[model samples]
Target: MVSPSPELALHGLVLLGTDTVYAVHMPTFTAPHDFQAVLRVTLDTDTYRTARKRYGTSALFTARPRTLLLKDLQPGATCPADLYFGRFGRDGEPLGEVSITIEETVYVGHPAAEPRTLRYVLFGREQLYLSHVLTRPPDFDQVVTAQLAGEWWASGSGAETPARTVTVPDRPDDLTGRLRPGEQLTADGTQLQVLAEVYLETADLAAGGV
Candidate 1:
């Protein structure tokens, strides 16, 4: 039988001079056949001081398409995926669009085979990115028109700057030993969230007599 679904969480901190962006990915597996993806974006100004110390600046910001989420996949599975961000004018008109595409492949074990299963692969991600930038962005949204054709990668192990840690400064004479806190502000006065989910149909192979 298939194992129980696992829980995964990924968090990243980005510093924009006056603002900070926190990207959070949380996945909760409900049923053996069901899944859920959650993404949240939080802006904190209180962390400004820490950000400045780390990034060497204080003013930070996000361009547009404030939030995004993509979800649902077996633990070892991968797949080609496409993502798009669109801007809208004050009048609610389409402004421009930006997109990212990823090639993904997924691997699952075959019960009868003991150590191996099936793999799913696709190539549309690259095409989708190209089409969006070369054609869709210009036709749909101009704000992101300049960002149409580009390659992007989703989550994976790669080189990343080490996370810096800071200590709260304590005063010489404070009996309570409380350290002064920094300011915290929200991004664009709004909290951004994104969620993505994937589910595996394990029995499909057996049903197909594979």
Candidate 2:
């Protein structure tokens, strides 16, 4: 990637350094916040961190990611505070320059992963959730071997769902976690099945109403 020109003005929190990644905890704000917004960086070059979500801000957000390229920038580097926000892999690039008085300096080191926002490899449908985000993708054209815990939710009746861990080894693209009925996950180009799906219906949007 080419160096991020000093002409664009960034518009979010600035890192004192690039030696570490930042975990953002924004206060609950009303609509229009675009909470799932991805954090962009400009330490001589442009890079981005993936937002954990693309919708509501109920979930904790991990913003201000560290890109692999930062390993080269020396400490005390400066960055402008005119960052831009937009859809993932879409538009929202920022530009312009800032006066020395307003520019922020790099105080930390670059995070291990580029696009430094941390992620979870969790699995859930409705009430269920994924355990982690770093869970590696299964090898191509191969069945996935994995372990999952499903005893967290007390959501069953008569025969309450047992709280026991299960082995989900070598199952092709087996996906677990919050998902809608129409959506599906794929492995090795195969569509994964939805063991359990969860969702809510609102006056503005419903499963079929949307």
Candidate 3:
């Protein structure tokens, strides 16, 4: 209903050790009531194309800056480099972009462990939240349709809020990524889950769900 303020900063999570970056946009509009959005992971075209060539294109979808999966990466390894989130609308309209110039990596148990965590920041302020490194390349079957608030908007400046995150398999018990209609998953102080049920309002306007 309202446009995001230009002053708002983009905040989200980056899958540590990979080119995958999850830009946590503001909540989207849902049916009965608005619900939280999911961790929207995006990848550069070259990186995405490489994954398609290595892992097969059957599971992937086409987008300018693609989303999902990184190939031949090992856990705990430093990411290729800082990444950017090129914002887009549900109708595939252009929004704005933000880049993660600085990053700080943190480890839980051992310094060298699968699914390690990292934070993406800019000027000491967190631009990205804590995210994990998958033990192996994520399977396309990992993608699941869940209820989310529709549309992407800027996260107006403020403290980072807890939001929903997609389930990544082969991690810790909590990271196992499973959700019933009402269950929730909490990781690294981040709350994630599937909302009951809702539809994107933009479907009434344009094409594609985004």
Winning model by lDDT = 3
lDDT of 2 by residue, 1-210 (tens): 112322222222321112122211111111221121112123433332232133222222112222211222223444333333431123434432331121222121111223212232222222222111111222011111122232233332222112121232333222333232333454233233433321111221111100
Q: State residue 123's C-alpha deviation in candidate 2, in Å.
A: 19
lDDT of each: 0.20, 0.24, 0.26
Q: In candidate 1, how many Å is residue 151 off? A: 36
Better of 1 and 3 by lDDT: 3
The true-structure Cα RMSD of candidate 1 reads 20.6
lDDT of 3 by residue, 1-210 (tens): 122222222222222112332322222122211112123343433553344345331222222223222221123222222222221333332322322222222221111224533221111012223222122222111122222233221233433334323343344422233333454444444344433221112222122121
The estimated TM-scores of all candidates read 0.18, 0.21, 0.23
Model 1 alpha-carbon miss at residue 195, Å: 34
Candidate 1 lDDT over residue span 1-210, tens digit each: 122233322111111212222211111122221221111123222333343345332122122323222243233232221111111121222222322121111111112212211111111111100000001100110000001112232223232212211122222211132111122212222211111111111121222211
Candidate 1: list runs displaced more than 4 Å.
Answer: 1-59, 64-67, 72-96, 100-161, 171-210
